[model samples]
Target chain A: MTASTAGTRLAIDASDLVKTYKGGVQAVRGVNLRIPAGTVFGLLGPNGAGKSTLVRMLTTLSAPTGGSASVAGFDIVRQQKQVRRAIGCVAQNSGVDVQATGRENLLLQGRVYGMRGVELNRRADELLLRFGLAEVGNRFVKTYSGGMKRKLDVALGLMHSPQVLFLDEPTTGLDPEARSEMWEQIRELAWDQGLTILLTTHYLEEADQLARNLAIVDQGRIVVEGTPDELKAQLNGDAVSLELAAGSDADTAKSIALEQGGVLSEIGVDGLTLRGRSADGAGAVPALLAALEAADIHVASVTVARPSLDDVYMRYTGRSFNAAEQAAAHAAKEEKK
Target chain B: MSALADTWYMTGRAFRAFLRQPMYVAFTLIQPMIWLLLFGQLFKSVTQLPGFGASNYETYLVPSIVVMSGFFGAGWGGMAILDDLTRGVLDRFLVSPVNRASLILGRLIVQVLSIVIQAIIILLFGAAVGASYHHLVMGVLVLMVATNLLATAIGALSYGLALLVRREESIIAASNFVLMPLQFMSTGFMALVLMPHWMQDITKFNPVNWTLVAGRGALGADPDWGPIFENLGYLAVLMVLCAWVSTRAFRSYQRSM
Candidate 1:
């Protein structure tokens, strides 16, 4: 597998990619993305947002039902093996053999890629050292800590030095310390090696911290795509949050909040809590309070904060990210019953 | 790497993993020894009956026990595939350039090796009990070859079910359903002539009987070369059929993915 030359050429170019599984579940719908070489891109979404389905299709693990995608200039459908060779995938689930030692796991992965002899051994050793797994390299992976197992998963994917790496929900289950360590490692991989990394995550903070560019996927579609700062900056103001008193109709409060001039977007409500965007949050507070009181809505508290990825998601998807997540969970629970 | 080279590498890895589980190997060997001693003592008078194949019941029982061990051991080979599947190790192999057939074949090779070892242990135990392989060296070699082919064929079927079922409880349940009935229906523990006329007719088509008849023909003072070669032919065909079924199962598994 040859690496692409340094240029503005796209490392990953996917257009209107769609995946409809058996039983008519459409996991990915009309996803379009263009990621340039040597960038850390994140596909940010809550659970069941189809982030993994898109990653699976790109990695050649699952086939898409419609549209097309190309990874490292190889067609995902016509040149599947080429795509598989060009890109490394660290799936959501850990893929390391639990009974095998960390070193043996790396060697097995390298051999599967057709690497053998002294060169394969040297590369395996180098990765163990790089991922801080050299100390326990001989121990079976079942005995490794969760963080160490995750590190080895990443190390396995990097054994062949592919041009592009796909890390699906890389930090979903890691503790804070391990998450930061993984973030540092990802930063180094992109900065030092110039590796193009496509990372998927549900953690908005993870995307904000580690990704140079990101797309917010919700319910099988990309709601918005840009750098984290740019996406948040598009809101152009502070987020005004208020806790309405009990028995207050959130819809009525929203209507009152919208009537106040300078309200930039819809008022997001989760039960008695309401939020909206405004250019001058402090200046509009008194008018908003008066309007709410006049409408018989009692305001318990109010706070103004800088826009975050959450607010950006709220702006595009028309629902608070947290609420969408809760609703999805509740739906899943109901289905289980 | 070529498919053969890949198969060899995977076979080595699988064999090492199997060796690490010393308890599993110990139990696998211990079970057959118990069966040989306990069952041999219990049925020692069966040779006195007419139409019995041999005077020494120990010699008559040795070959059947070896074939039974091979069959029983191979019936659980699917558990290995299930472990690989649930752990995502199989997916790692699937996404790579490794040969698909080699993955299934490598696990079968481990089963074949285990079957040979089990057969040797039984043979040594029979020797200690005054049961001799009059053909001696050639008898042991032929028995190993027969057990190896039988184990691999059954192993292929076991792994095929693993890929299809993809559940441990289901595989264990399915194994229990097939193994004992298969053994009793064949001439595994009794002479075909001693069985009912109907059982004798049906046992001729049973794969386990083919293995047992071939294995017993190679043992004792008068070695029957004709039936041994003929039964070996039947086992060779069964081996190819099982391998093809496993290959098709792998394809269905990929499509499901």
Candidate 2:
């Protein structure tokens, strides 16, 4: 179990991790990561960015192609049994057995981890209640709603009270309400249990809300990594938006706005909207107003807001997060075919 | 403490799931019963030939029915593997500290036990219709071992196929395409002498024929130890081969993922 004994702060550490599938599909290409204990670390990436593959490797489902990783101070490859003992994995696919009841699933999982007798039964019941699955614990999982099934999957993963918990796209196919509820549960698990969590998600808002620190991965590599506030602060300005009056010429308005004392960051012709970044939106707004007035462009409304994670992603990638996700998903489907 | 305690824990879950859907159990039992009642009646008069060893047709048919029920039940064992693969349940177990061999062994053990129970029921039905075992205890023991060995081999083979294809439809199609012909070609429904000389020669290599021979040896008035031991040996070898194949299939499935 070649693990770093340098203090106790690091929960998970990886260096130059590489995973290549058959036919030379480089799913994870030389990635490096470090996660602190008791923090919710988010691996932010679009579909096919190798998030699930990395999770699988770390959890010992698959071995890495190159480099090395350690989870909870145990080498992922050399001490796979210890790694398996220390980490709880809630995979992208629902792992619950639909033929078995919720309680049955948890009990089986607990027993697999070497828990038995009274301790196993107590843990199963406790998790059922904690995850809000007590009511349906005796019912077959086939009758469970999608949200309930996913929750039970998480509960099953948590049956052994592992030190590290891995959640791969925990709310990918969930409804909005269910997604929020899942987010809350994830937060509670980290806060209440002090469990180190590693989560992967395509949703920018989900990463922004839950992650204390995150890495943006694209095409099997990390593009950037930092706290959400630190990443957003990299934009270096307040974002100012001007909603032009109906039928206004957006191109002409954008040209006039660019001439003002701020940098024109974006121009949307469809909505006749103009966006600019500046140190002082209050002063820059008047200057932009004067410029637009001189250009004879009517403005319906104007507002300025702080730079968000989306703006930070746009600055780095030159594409909206959602657009990148769509492209990645399309590429994944094509590869499958 | 028990050799079968782990098997029980694992088999208990499968049985619970099986019991949850009573219709599935009914359907599983019905197919074998049809083969016993209908097929047995159709082939009754054929046993009048010399060296048939049984005076009554029911007596000769009972052992075949027991082996056939085991054959049919074991064919569907791979469905459980396919279901687990599709639902991500197998992945969950992979990451846990669960004994991997136990997972496959448990399912095979459950299917074998279920088939044995069904064989007992069929034996009782045969008795009611003028069938009787000369060595009843030894016959029951022989049937138990024969059914268990046959079911385990077939179940493991099916599990291997399930992992190879990783789809329910493919697993079902392959099992059906393979087992139905093998059952018909074996001595499960007829005496070896009743088959053509070429077919009789072919039956020598069929594991199902070995099961039928062993099962019948225990039930017949003239019990034959030589053929019974030979059949048991053949089945033991086949069981090892199928178990190895299934383990390799499981590894390949994990690698693909």
Best by DockQ: 2
Estimate candidate 1's alpha-carbon lDDT, on a 0 to 1 scale: 0.86
Maximum-TM-score candidate: 2
Q: In DockQ, how does model 1 score against the reference complex?
A: 0.57
User: Model 1, range B127-216, lDDT digits (tens) per residue?
Assistant: 798676778787777777887788888889999899998989988998899888888988766777899898888888888888887878
What tier of docking accuracy does candidate 1 attain?
A: medium
User: Could you tell me which residue pairs clash in candidate 2?
Assistant: none
- Worst-scoring 10-residue span by lDDT in model 1 chain A: A1-10
lDDT of 1 by residue, A172-284 (tens): 78999999999999999999999999999988899999899999999899989999989988987888889998898998888777766556465788988898778778888
For model 1, what is the alpha-carbon lDDT of residue A168? Answer: 89
DockQ score of each predicted structure, in the order shown: 0.57, 0.72
How well is each residue in A26-145 modelled by candidate 2, as lDDT tens digits?
A: 999998999998899999877887888888988999989999998988888998878888889999999898988899899888877767899999999999998889999999899999
**Full-model lDDT for every candidate:** 0.86, 0.84
DockQ measured for candidate 2: 0.72
TM-score (0 to 1) for chain A, all models? 0.83, 0.89
TM for candidate 1 is 0.90
